[model samples]
Target: MPGPAARDAQASGSPLIDTHGRVHRDLRISLTDRCSLRCTYCMPEQGNEWLARTSILGLDEIERVARVAAASGITTFRLTGGEPLLRTDIVEVVRRLAAVSGPDGPVQIAMTTNGIRLREVLPQLIDAGLSRLNISLDTLRRDRFRDLTRRDRLDEVLDGIAAARDCGLRPLKINAVAMRGVNDDEIVDLVEFAIAHDAQMRFIEQMPLDAGHTWDRSRMVTRDEILAALSARFTLTPVPGRGGAPAEKWALEGGPHTVGVIASVTAPFCGDCDRLRLTADGQLRNCLFSTTEYDLLPILRAGEGDDAIDAMLRSCVHGKLPGHAINDPAFLQPARGMNAIGG
Candidate 1:
């Protein structure tokens, strides 16, 4: 009884078109809940309790689920983690995901990494079909980097960024979480750094995802503040057609570079959000701020076919909330931190 469009939609396995018609085409998969750096905003300065090895999904499992998602209209996959590169089989992971295709053709593959170990894996990752990269660089000062991330590997990260550029990773990006009274003073410096390297810089407002539960809105820098700082030094022109993207981007007037701001706290983009997250342990998070997650490991390991997995995937997206509810007074921080949830 379905019409041609309905049949085509069903046949395509597009999960984004829920009953509410919110279509999510981007999927973020966390390879592991382990990390090399101790970023104060993401994790406690002391350390984190890592997920058990047995709990995490294998690379093959991740690939299988991703294949189904891609067939269902998921065109973008971004590998995240406490640090995804820390996984031993990361190259294979990329290789398998690179082969997945949707109605639109080959899926776009990208990653968000701390850039510590990128020096060793950048070449192989590029060869394995990684087309995009977003490296986290918080501070330009060596001492500040060490103090913030609790690691003395600033030089290594810089080298990784250079290597990523040299490897022909088109549109390499730098993500810096700007906080008031912390690294806010380095906005221009970070912008200059991105421009110098032919990379795009995105300043994200600090969110409430730290393991230490120390995110204070008072200390968080808003996008307006970031733009004000940038405007004082440079002329910025808005780039239209953000679509479901989290960052509102801009072009520096009279330059070939671009800058962006992900104002998750001050500016919410949940209405046009087109993302679904899968944690390292095979749990599906409908939203980054989702309080609950659906476990997929049991069903996956139970030898269920693609049909069953597809049903669960549909149910999860069907129940996805309209928004992340960050502005509501009732908004409670997610039980898991950003690193655990695949930031």
Candidate 2:
């Protein structure tokens, strides 16, 4: 049950509104907490226990939740995971989500993947109505890739990126986490790689989501530093029209495409946050760093109707914090890692 504050907000007729007046419009759904690669930044080398099969939401339940959310104004849906592609029924999930329509039209469906298993499945996914992609490729060197993800699959990932382009996954975006000692030196090289593939690039500052809780600020390459590195090599200017987007955009002076930076640590964009997360285990989280979660699975499993589920979700959103307290002195790291929290 929600607290008194949430109840009061619901009385105002918009349960999704936080006290700060932010409206939720984007929903990130984690299909599974299972991944093919064990990225050092995401999970431990040995890894944590995986969720039980019975705990995860069924495809039908997922579609029902998505439909309710779409009707309530969540226009964008991003499928995440420990590795969403690891789910055997991922194509079927995409197909169901693609059919959910709002007043405007079909909901926009996107995915964030590691790209290891993407080469063979890219065509099926694209044909199943996946609209966009954000591939996580931290390094181009095979050895470095193996070290980062504990997997020697850089060749496969590169192949996947190329396949994504050939299949018309237009405006593809490559996401790279900028860590000081690890892959920071290759920022420019990554930019070049994106250019060659006709894909956009976004360099992100590493956050405190590692399973081992070993994240160090000193190792995090800030946005300013990334821009400085890029600027030293090429002319750069800001691109306009970034509303509530996590990434700040900049166009390369000589190129037609642009690059971006998601500086969550240095530049918090909580004021413009319009997104929420649904864990693979069927918990609704208002913020990525939230300590409390609203369980929707029990209601789903009990065969509650759409109205009952909708009201519960609304109450959950009303309890959202104004911002993730990343900069606060009393900030607390979430108990779950990025993998469990839906990335």
Candidate 3:
């Protein structure tokens, strides 16, 4: 039987439905395909090509697409990037998206950032209607952080986390990518750090989204391995009703603090996924691993109205595969890395 949330979603008359009967309500918008750090798991340390400034969508173009999405029943807009905080006009972006209204109400605004520049812009962002935050921090050790991201900005990230907490961003999520020989040893320690900061710690299993296409399955950490490492330190009580959210959450020791794992590889959750991604260059992606993308910039620039965008969105969702198919024998990594695709 469908739960109340599912039943309600079905009754909402949303057009963002796939052939598999999934109703899409979440949209991940990538502001830019540029980042300050080059995480080994995400991009190459050098020789990475970025989109031309003219090819990237402008603020007005982004808002128009978002407005169409909101009218089509998308309720939440998560702003991402190579690093969203890197965008100079991010606060204005939030202000614009927050003003967009859906059937339910004004759209919910959220962001996923590296946290290096968070402290400088968080106050302005909050004032501009930013509601939720997720900061990426892989390792607690400074030297390891430098090696993992090829940047010595761990202290800046930590300060950003503290600033976010002080600003009252409850359930402030700290995202860490789990790797086999790299930061896997810090899984339990990362969770403990989240507890100390009153934040929810989420560990994401590294996917084959690297710009260099050098991802090795043997070197990737699995969800079971992450859970096993945590179990040795604290009691984890599974939190039920994950719905469409990516992370599988667990309450630590049956209390307030909790930890989550986004097992994209080991335990795929494509059946209930409601996310639709809009790349910084105005490409619409059905799945993170999708090789196919529908370019929206030309249409928008060509003076096509909302009807055109709405049709494109429906067309994209209609073609959504049953799952990401990462486990398939024929699975191929996306041509663009996570930075370009939007994390």
lDDT of each: 0.89, 0.88, 0.91
TM-score of each: 0.96, 0.95, 0.96
Distance from true position, residue 104, model 3, in Å?
0.7
Model 1 lDDT, residue 148, Cα: 90
Candidate 1 lDDT over 201-269, as tens digits, reads: 999999999887888999998999999999999999999999998999999985578999999988998
- Runs in model 3 lying further than 4 Å from the true structure: 1-13
Please write out the lDDT profile of model 2 over residues 1-343, one tens digit for every residue. 9898766656423335666888788999999998888899899777488888999998999999999888777788999998999899999999999999876678999999988789888888888989999899999999999999998888888988988877777779999999988999999999999998999999999999887888888999998999999999889988888998999999998558899999998998989899989999999998888899999999899988888767877867778777788878898889889999996
> On residues 1-343, what C-alpha lDDT tens digit does candidate 3 reach at each position?
9787544433323558887989899999999999999999899888999999998998999999999999879999999989988888899999999999998999999999989888899999999999999999999999999998999988899999999989997769999999888899899889989998999999999999999999999998999999999999999999999999999999999988999999999999999999999999999999999999998988999998777888788779878999988989999899999999998
- Clashes in candidate 2: how many? 0
Off by over 4 Å in 2: 1-15
For candidate 2, the lDDT comes to 0.88
Return the TM-score for candidate 2, rounded to 2 decimals. Answer: 0.95
